[model samples]
Target: MNVLSENNSITETAILVNPNLGHPRFLEIDQKLKKKKFQTCLLFISDKRDPAYIRDYLNDRIKIVPILDYKWQSQLLLERERKEKKGFLTKVKHFFKRKKKQISELLSQKKIEKTQRRLESLKSRVYRGSPIFPSILEVRSVLTHSIHDLEYINNEYCIPQDYLIKNHAFETLDVFYEIKIEFTLADELLDLFRIRNFIMFDIVQEKNGITERINYHSLVVSKNNWHDFTFVQATDLHLAQRNDRIYGIIKEWMDTFKIENLELIEEAYKKDQKTKKREEQAELFKLPLKRRFVNPNNQFRIFIKLMNRKVFRNELEFVVLSGDLIDFTLLSKLPKDIKKYVDFDYDFSNWKIFKKIVLNFPQKKRRGVIKGEELLCPIFTILGNHDYRPYHYDIRWAGLYRKLGLKLEEALAVNDKLLALPISAIVKSKRALRAYWSQVNPLNDFSIKLGNNNFIFLNTGSDSFKNFLDLITGHPSLTGLTTKQIIYLQNLASHKIQQKKENSFLFLHGPPINPKGKRSFLKRLSKKISGKIITKLDEFKESVIKKIGIKKDTRIDGKFNVKTGTVSTNWSSLIEFCKNYCNLTLAGHTHSLKEFRLDDPKGLKTRVFNAPPFSLKKVENPAAVYYDVYSEIYTSAKDIEKAGPFVVQTPALGLGGYRNPDLAGAYREIVIKEDKLDSFKVKFIDR
Candidate 1:
């Protein structure tokens, strides 16, 4: 089928297609969509799952084609090439090529010195028992291959350029093909799907190798008449494949070297133990290694079940996952030499786990029916600081120490440098970006208009590594709001204002206004002196903290209190936009339920208020009264009403704020009735 057309204004819906699920192609799609100027409900063909769900949003607007017997010719060819056997001559040629590259890397004096400095820096950080350092050969090997290995593992999914260009299946702006079906959905689907956002499709050929199946899902646009709806806002779902106790054990060892290599040492000691008492002591060390942390993977599954129940009852419209959707960008591969006590793969990444848990897969027919635990509603996701992490700190550190014979401190130093790589470095490598674009949403910043309400999503960006101080003190100001993002928000806000939109809500990863109490007098003075030379600390403090009178003060720990100007860049502009345009601004990096009403529109003053904990039970029932819950905590309706035009930080839904179990698995339920903001309540998974 060949469908080609110029830019035309159609329905407010756009489809993003990524046939081969390549990162570079996805990036190209992102660039092309930005130039598009139209209001649209973006329908992305995320995976190979049958997008019958697309029918729910796109009601008879375009013709539905049932593709059958279609094969992914390019993918098949790629598989064959990957499986092709190399001859002796070819193997010899490849071996020489690799040796030449390694020799070249080792010969560079600049590279050798840089590697030695890094190794020395790592050695300096270790203060434990007589530590074993890498040999000169090992150091040279690291210099020659570590970065290459890291980059290769990260970009493992990138398709070859030759195959990508040759594939007739590749389509982005204007669809072109010469398949049996020679019709274009472009003109018909354009008006209804005319959206400005980037869309990526996962089009898989059907079994008979003659047809194509377009797996897609549509978004609710202005054309939809339903004004009243309820949506859930969940954040910081640090999802991983498994909650390995090895990570926790490594963390314990790193904090105090007294427990260094306890597991491996115990295993070695067990064989030599003759005394019963010695065996018991070895078993004691084993206990801690076997002790697992709270499984984020399980928690997310439970959350999906709850959401499914809500959808079954017709109580929810959609879900907005603010950020921290995964613990790290890529899952760590446990050293194969290590004993496996768990049932699953040690190297199962979150992206694979996410697909298995969240999306539907082709299933064997039972009584002519297929089944899977696919979420019943659309979900929009953004990236968080954790999502930008390339590797797990604990796993990588453990690998360097145990497998590579690096000292515990040396391993820690090496891993720290890797973790501190900037956001640009992470995204450019394309591992995290690949998982995100393929499994989650494509655009980092986007806006959707549903009826009279406007929902804007922005990416606050990865962990701030502005300088050495940022790495040490963990300054929140390094969390970015790029100039482009600020401009995007400005444009969206301006458009909303021009359209006379009744209600507007802003969703971002980092909160713009986070206030904390003063530090110790000595510490404060030291920080002041250091700030002059290194970082400029935001000294903005709230004068009316006691006056606000928040009842249930959950921020008992001081860790959640990030300073005012430290949370994000373009702080003043974001605040101004929220105050003047948005009715509510929701964020979740702090991982705790905190709300602050922007009291002073011109300055950084906010009135803190306690949001009453509302449960899913109360939400399930339509007639359930919230007055009692509200009145019990708040003095009057006016006090509750004052929360309008507010900034609310929802608690994390996966990992806890201070690793507190009770504080985790929390989400917010937002209700919009008759095009007006109603209730924004924090709810927990168990409740």
Candidate 2:
């Protein structure tokens, strides 16, 4: 019989009849359910133990129902007799099995160590001559307390040092701030030495592999020390390449769902038709749709004029477009012309439209965007989730290379270049932007020095796989830095600090922390459970293979493995770096204008500035959407009658959701004084 009734969909009742499962296990289940905020009646079916035995374990929050079964008591008696007869033999078998398992575990540990050693050797060669880090000794000295050569693990790899520092730097920085000597010479020389105050230092390597430090403050000009520079940050542009493209995307989506939800699709189409009517009536003012795609020129014209006005005119340094530089993908919506899809093809028509939209910004002769006096500053950009070709396509996908009429590698190359071309061209055209991207890790990673300050720009979109996973999980700033990349950043900052830059600033598409907490509790919980299940299944498979005597060597993959790798999207590393090394970080994926000052254990604080989307139209708000598929998958009419929809609601997007009345379109002006953070002010542009 089922423990819980098949008709009980809401999990309103739980009956625990197995006494052998133990009180701890019984109470564990109770607590787990309660943590999920489930309301249920718990009943214990046992004659050996009274209901009072579990009463203390559960409180007023859970309802207790008692049912004593005499048949269960007879079953227990039979089980005890069976155990008495076979317990010794079972114990003997388990003893040998346990011994074998222990030996297997030791061999697995050895394999893991051997793999790590090989990977470390490869990294040492790849990361040799790190410009920012002169030597591993320097990084280790700064990151960890003094340790002997024998005590050092993976001394050749700087990754271990990064982990040590990332884990404890915030707490250590807090201590300095608590003592009120955080900025003093001792504290400055120790904690802030490489991250901040070191910009004046020059490293001179001696013949014995020791590095001598030299300060170059005298060689630097006084005028260059001028700290006042302002830059604007706007994120999540979601620029639609063309007005027609939007209609096409929606139409395709409606077509896909027409058979199942015709009414819903029809309603959405009608809404689109109504919007078109409204757009015609409001010709005097730009429609939101027009502003987003059809005529962004006028919208951008208004914004440029505002920025060029008397109050803001002279203060602007440059503009940073955080992400979502485009709308739609290469295989946006599969073409409906084909009955049976044999191959995937680039939606060239959509690409052409997108190209036109991007060209409008760069073509000097284009009419709308460059209408008034153009702002001469360069605009630096990073890709958002939408910028890439579709990572997940329907099963009908036959692969883009076959459909695009190109070799697999050629198709991939074309996609890569096409996705990045517009931003690349824009960056190349501006002298400032060109110089910025040219420095250190020339691809999507860049570092620039403006006077005494260092700025780092990361391509969060490059880690497409991790980023895609993050989106499905609703994690903010899911793009993670690679261990090699983190070390490069460390070296970059080290050099900048040695050059006497006041502080380093990081620019990226996603905020390090989710502005809103992980949106769906159920999704997160399910992900956790699924991850555990996958891990166990992998282990089980490995064990079965070993039992069959099929041995395989353990290997370390190139990608950063969150379980065994150095860097992750944990934000603790970013926070620790900012708290100890860098000054302020600017991000904008959430499309909300907000400032965050994270506090350490002490009074020390690290600042994060979040920018609102530059585009007038709203993107899909992740938090506002309600998804019940996870809960629904486990419940059906037979499983839980009258369970409603088994819906799971996420936290609503506060100011960032589409069509929110309060979203007046905003940007932030960051003021830097003496290379240190001065203030970040949000400037709202009301349409």
Q: What is the RMSD of candidate 2?
A: 32.9
* lDDT of each residue in 340-436, candidate 2, tens digit only: 2412122232222332332222333422233443332334556554444322232112332222122223233333323333332111111111111
Write down the lDDT of every candidate, Cα atoms only. Answer: 0.44, 0.32
- Prediction 1 global C-alpha lDDT: 0.44
**Best candidate according to lDDT:** 1
What TM-score against the true fold does each predicted structure earn?
0.51, 0.37
Top-TM-score structure, candidate number? 1
Per-candidate clashes, comma-separated: 24, 13
Report the alpha-carbon TM-score of model 1 versus the true structure.
0.51
Looking at candidate 1, the ten consecutive residues that score lowest on lDDT are: 618-627
Error of 2 at 28 (Å): 66
lDDT of 1 by residue, 11-126 (tens): 12223332211111222122222322232122232212223333332222222221110111111222233445222223333323556566455324345445333322221110
Candidate 2, position 548, lDDT: 50
CA displacement after TM-score superposition, residue 657 of candidate 2 (Å)? 2.9
